[model samples]
Target: MHIISGHHHISMLSKDAKLNNHFYQQVLGLRRVKKTVNQDDPSMYHLFFGDMSGNAGTELTFFEMPNIGSTVRGSNAITQIGLLVPSYESLVYWKERFERLAVKHGEITTYAGRDALHFEDQEGLRMVLQNNNGEKVPDTWQAWTGSDVDPRHLILGMGTIEITVRHLNRLANTLTELFGYVEAYHSDNEAIYQSVDGQSFGEILIKQDLGPREKPGKGSIHHLAIRAKNEEELRYWEEAVKERGFYTSGIVDRFYFKSLYFRESNGILFEIATDGPGFTTDSSIDELGKDLSLPPFLEGRRSEIEKNLLPID
Candidate 1:
């Protein structure tokens, strides 16, 4: 029952890889760390970007499909993807930037016991930025490099990716039973389940009566990842996840870490992934994503795969 840590990453489906990359890289300022294909759907690209090290909570991934099926949003679709920052005051700074940049935005306020701002990416993915008191992350500021980003004012963790769920009790029970989340707090509209570890990691809020599921459309979260300390813990999760009635994927080794996938009763895909052998596994800490690192099984196809992909760096 030791749920090793918090979120490892979250994946969303994108209709346009180039536009998606542009928004995330330029607007959000996150670094693209890996470019590959979906293991299950190799025809589509899997793009990963986050903090400098691709740390546990810093990961934001995408499955690039310009022609993906039409998406719809309703209950069960991830509502807002939140990123936690330690800087409460810099929120004003971000506000100015958002305004100056002229990206569509909305008001700021205290949503879940924290000061927060709500906005959307170009693709219309709802995003929330909140001040996490003082929790900080390790990624270097490559996005707004000269723009007064204080690590002390750094992102604490990923803010809860808001999700719409039906039969809250069933999903709630499953979360408590299978995953390790507990009822941390609740707002006037939703119950917030947070990691006992006090992070945006694993924090989820089930908004009451968000209503029935719809087809996922542009700007919807495809899945979210939970951390499994290592192979042993992941194996435990594989069994536990099965016993609870969610069928999980057989172990799949990503070059940086390993993973097992399953879905919560609520239909949101969940991945239990390892945190070790990070992006540094293939290249020096200085050279991640400079070149492709293939698993032995795919080594022979490296030149071919590299050739088919879009240029990142």
Candidate 2:
């Protein structure tokens, strides 16, 4: 099996573009790396945020709707997003910062032997600042100098995400058998899986839940993307998934990356995307996200798209 390195990016839904932009860019200090429209829904804005270079593992994207309702939490939903910080001291710095900024956060706690600071964004997306296990590659991150957040303390990249499922066996088997993920740890209710390559970005925790189902709305994850090296690998994954009786939305060209999407046995949406032709493919890196960008197909309708999108500032 061709192994998935880690996360390419994770996309979520947000109701308010300005608030989402302010929270991610100004509050969390991530750089607004790309400003584009949702390919599937050209009228809606798609925003990308990440570290300075907007590398694969650091990306967090959003679909701006302005009026979407809140997500209902239950099975089949991505529950939390984990951001990796360098050390225990980094957690301390965030604790003080979250308090001063009045950001809602929970007490720092240790899970699976590492410390974490749990918090929520303005849209109530659950997030955590967690310490890495010293296995991450240093190249996975580039410094973000966009805000007062010290380069040393800025989020390194996306470390992991938590997903809730009714049963763990099927999803766990798919991850380990097909995706080359290994069971790092497990309990009756939760299990942690890590990529065999030891990359931190796509690590995931699957919580076994037998309660109510989750509803999708604003602040909910639309899909989690795992990294594929190229177009060939993406197609390979699609074939593999189809053979296993899973329905995959065969290779999609998103301009930045090619994608293949499918839901796991438990119904959580997952996407496999390539790592190249990134945000700088159109706009220069230095001027990324400064202007609204669209795919060539959508460029013809730029005037119509812009008129409908809410102004960012």
Best by lDDT, which number? 2
Candidate 2 lDDT over 1-313, as tens digits, reads: 5988888889999998898999898888899999899999988889999988688889999998876888888887888899988788888888999899899998889754579999998888889998874555547578588798866777888987888889888889999888889888888888889874455566888888898888888888888999899999998999999988899888999898899999988888999999888888898879988899898888899999999887886
Question: Given candidate 1, what's the lDDT at residue 287?
Answer: 64
Task: lDDT for model 2, please.
Answer: 0.86
lDDT of 1 by residue, 14-69 (tens): 88877887777666666667766776655567777777767777788888777766
The alpha-carbon deviation from the true structure for residue 303 of candidate 1, after best TM-score superposition, in angstroms, is 3.7
* TM-score versus the correct structure, for each prediction: 0.89, 0.96
Poorly placed runs, candidate 1 (over 4 Å): 136-156, 186-189
lDDT of each: 0.72, 0.86
- What value does the lDDT take at residue 117 in candidate 2? 94
In model 2, which regions exceed 4 Å deviation? 133-135, 138-140, 197-199
